[model samples]
Target: MSQTHSGTDATGAPVNAPEHVIVIGGGISGLAAAHRLAGAGVRVTLLEASSRLGGKLYADEIAGVPVDLGAESLLARRPEATGLAREVGLGDDLEPPAVLGAALWTRGKLRPMPKGHVMGVPGDLGPLASSGVLSAAGLARLPLDHVLPRTDIGDDVAVGAFVAARLGHEVVDRLVEPLLGGVYAGNAYEISLRAAVPQLFAAMREGRSLIEAARGIQRRAAASAGGGPVFNGIRGGVGRLPLAVAEACRALGVTIETDTAVRELRRTPHGWQVVLDGRALAADAVVLAAPAPVAARLLAAESPAAAAELGGVEYASMALVTMAYRRRDMTRLPYSSGFLVPPVDGRTIKASTFSGRKWGWLGEAGGDTFVLRTSVGRHGDEADLAWDDTDLVRLSREDLEAAVGLRAAPVAARVTRWDAGLPQYPVGHLDKVARIREQVAKLPGLALCGAVYEGVGIPACIASGQRAAADILPGIVAAGS
Candidate 1:
């Protein structure tokens, strides 16, 4: 057990005690934070309200074969996620997608996704026009972006509104919304330009047209990235990442407890007192890695200002319906990884991923069985989620039949619903995050991290955790001396 002291020296200075840090929440973010703190030789205790770890990254069996029911891939371009995977002994298991490129299911057909676009804001109109993704009038109006006056993006603006003004509604509705939806599960018209796509926002601030900005971004990426795979996954499942991280933390002597809810948090003269159901734990520092609402409730009495800001952060709910089928039952397989559906098409499902085709391991493991999954629900359009699991699977099959001529029945099906899965970023979300951080910083030994901050991606969440660990380390080091 770590030594806990609650007194001051003769000079009124805080008495030194061995650093004991507590991390609330057992998601990837919390695990990452605990790993970092433990690596620094601090005695750390991680508490989770749930029975299991890996909040959004979960793996399960479908038809006697392992499959990822939650997040299946990681952005290979980002180092945080991939780097963490390597650190946790998954270095050799990292596998890139077997297939690449996807189609956009719009206009009653599947059109090849156009090249040279930043989140579907076309840089080269030639491919966009040839792709048949837009109507004649929409194609003609695209050039108007070059002639429009510079719109004042005072503090922040909506991604859809800015792109619609510079291009037109067709572009935002057909391309931007669907692409952004895949990431945020929120309407582009409501998402923040500054928070969602900072690079595009920066380019626009320099007086360049959206087209030029997108082209430049593509060119720079091509030159610097050397055409590496955009995404990567583990051989078994990306969901195994958090489990591996937790194991590494345990090896380092970090204490992790699940099904343990933290009821209250109070600041002590020396550090903090974390109140639970029957007892309390003392720590030199605390990392709040819970979701926004949970964090708000825990911090209400300690930091009301920060709690209010966290309370304002909204979230989007979603579900993934996974199904497995016999390969012989299908007449043809999807050529690419998958396709994204535009909401304007009035589809029940938002997107589908051909797991067997996308992941080489899954294909080889399944042998005669083919697997695929479809996502349902979004920010404001979650009525579909109210349906039961069987209904969601049925609705998914109905759309799959229309989108890809998939009429065969599956051998097994599973529905994984992530209620409030992703955090939504409104117009001034970045500014709001800054205020929340400022308020938390005022309280010594308190720091925050999660999808509610900079981003919702796996890498972003890991980076957020690392940042929180770094923030409180200095205080812990000083008190230990």
Candidate 2:
């Protein structure tokens, strides 16, 4: 349930005016904010350019079974998403992965992923060797991290460069690349360490052994969670989250308008005005939950500096090929949950998840068929995306066959393309976001929040949206008073 707010005057009477906030965008972030504001008795008018809500979180049917075409898992360490799910009556359906581990297909073999890692930064060297992710020569050089002279990273360094300096190129190429790709779809060499893995970056700044630092961090994480699940998913699908939030918004009396794009956003004498469907909708405040480019265009006139900064924020496009196969096929199942393919592996499919093994619920619905998803086309891989869905499926199967030696035709297949789906946090990205936020602060009643500003995870996006709502809530109350 949304929290209550104390907005009444000392005598518990009406103030200057009713607080009204116009929220732009219909993604998870915007929906969450609208829900909160509405619960606080603030009239909310939300404008979504698309025909439906849930920007990237989507649920669809495949072979008569409900499935998610976009993000599917939630990091349980963060309470934002899981907490909201409970508030929306999804608490009973929360589940963790059945299998806890994954594999890596690299260097002409399938190997177990090394354990004790903070995004591929190894805390223990034993698993790295046992997993065969690195060669004997590669393993030999890991100890040099102790003898090698200390390296200095000024403000921030690329994750690849920093890890390679400490661990080795092999670790960055095979371990870090695929791990980062699962979320960023970008090269590890260009990802910002400070932004992507802050704890590890802080460890590096402490001027100690990264291995020891990783172990310490891992111990703290384990102690904090008390050995609970690290990740969770809804029984139906993660895509259901947005729908629940939207329904809650409705219950709170939020006016949600779909296919209503905000074409113009201008500052008025009172506060802010948004022109949509040829009519101006004015409100005391505005919350921006759109993508960087969309937000940039909307705020260009009011704050050109912020708009330019947002425009510079880049994005990565990718596609998913989901296929269901009959269990009778003459093949074997992967021992682990799935496998990740590093970009250096020279394969078309970047990663494959054994949904059947990972999600026990998927087995309950999928009686005779085993389902899995293959992801392809990361950042700087435009040529791979040029192929149509059919060819994409073919290439995915080809790569799957080479990796797992499964030639059985898929009983059913579905391809979903996400053009510029995820934002890319290159080096110095946090600084850019800081500049954008600072510039936006100068404009009254204008706040921006999305995957571009802080984080790309569902929880992070929700937090960002809630923060935006909180930032303007005080001003909205004061203006009304």
Candidate 3:
């Protein structure tokens, strides 16, 4: 017999509903799952081991100003993040990054980042040379990619190998390293092209030179449709995204608990048994929306195979040093958004975001204080985190003085360190995810979703959570029936 129950949609529209769902993880993904379930009229309970609801979507008041301590922006193209915002009454609050270009700081000089490039692959030669990003030899070697025959890429390859082979190491070091670093905080040589930049990989498979493919991809993006900022942020900060989602979940009758750690998960004759704060909770379905390690631990006894595969996933840690300076304290600030430093330069800071110039909202609230944040450390490069917060601020100031010519000491400085901040998506990560998913699927009412399994961006995580929630709903219905 098919079971049918009524529940309301995100917009309060009524629809069929499932039974209760236990979401283990209160981050954006977990919260999204709970929200979607409640919208569909399913009972949901969200447990967060930490005191806060947002995992990495952290925000705090610094110098009497509300600022995002974690992610600051969401990719607008991915409708997941933006769509959720609208459902939660955050649509009007959506803001875009200022229409200002950023630069690369390297070679003891601030160079203009090339305008036409696919993740640092030059689509136009003119900008590449004029930007001073590459040496004379590097510039000369770029053209070689046009004439070289197509290289064979098996199933998958590292992003660095594919790009370096066609454009030489200079392009990878000067261009790709910094750009990829800004996103993954991992080495290009180890990051998967298919996973990280799928469009670039698909274009490369067309049996054309990497340079031409990159240009074609860029041309497509340009010729597509309306032009707008690629990313969107909340008026205050992206940190509010999770808060709004949690509130929406509660409005839908979802029970959300914080400071409650799920110590264990066991498969019961009835859905599953969740051990949390020494109490057992029953659920018709379970959604594991946590980091790889935590998920691995929870699933270890139930499914050792899945645990082993997930344990292999590695992570990278980093720290964000945010500083505020009085406008009068600095002689001048750069006209553009900010800059990135390649790993090859051995700089302590990897990238900087000119918050005041990039986000008009922050600037308006900041008044005379110009705010920006510098990222430090990456995969296999985390010695900077060992230094005290004061030293980290000092080193960041020194780098800024050289790169941006800032001599003013910051009136407010805060350092937020994220241990295991990013998960490394090495080659064949997709395959591993597939295997893990298959094993977990064998047990009805169990589903997994997170950055480790899918894309790392906020939108991707939301999509994964929604998809997982949808997948498990059928099982919930069937079990109850």
lDDT of each: 0.89, 0.85, 0.86
* Candidate 1 per-residue lDDT over residues 82-168, each given as its tens digit: 888998999999999985779999999889998889998888888998999999999989999888886567788999999998889
Give TM-scores for every candidate, taking all chains together and pairing residue i with residue i: 0.95, 0.94, 0.95
What residue runs in model 2 are displaced by over 4 Å at the alpha carbon? 1-18, 475-481
Q: Please write out the lDDT profile of model 2 over residues 177-229, one tens digit for every residue.
A: 99999989998999998899888888878876778778888889999997889
Cα displacement (Å) at residue 86, model 1 = 0.5
Return the number of clashes found in candidate 2.
0
Models sorted by lDDT, best on top: 1, 3, 2
Candidate 2 TM-score versus the reference: 0.94
In candidate 2 the C-alpha lDDT for residue 95 amounts to 90
Q: Indicate the residue-level lDDT of 481 in model 2.
A: 17
Candidate 3, residues 1-481, lDDT tens digits: the string is 1235554555767654347789999989888888877877788899888899877788775666678888889988777898889989999999998988999998888888998898888888889989898898998888888888996677789999888888899999999989998888999989999899888888777787787888898888877636965799898889998999999998899998888888999998767899987689988789999899999999999999999999999999999999988867755778888999999998899999988788888988888877888999999999889999999999999999889888888889999998997899999998999999989989877888788887888888888888888776642221101
- Clashing pairs in model 1? none
**Segments of candidate 1 deviating more than 4 angstroms:** 1-18, 475-481
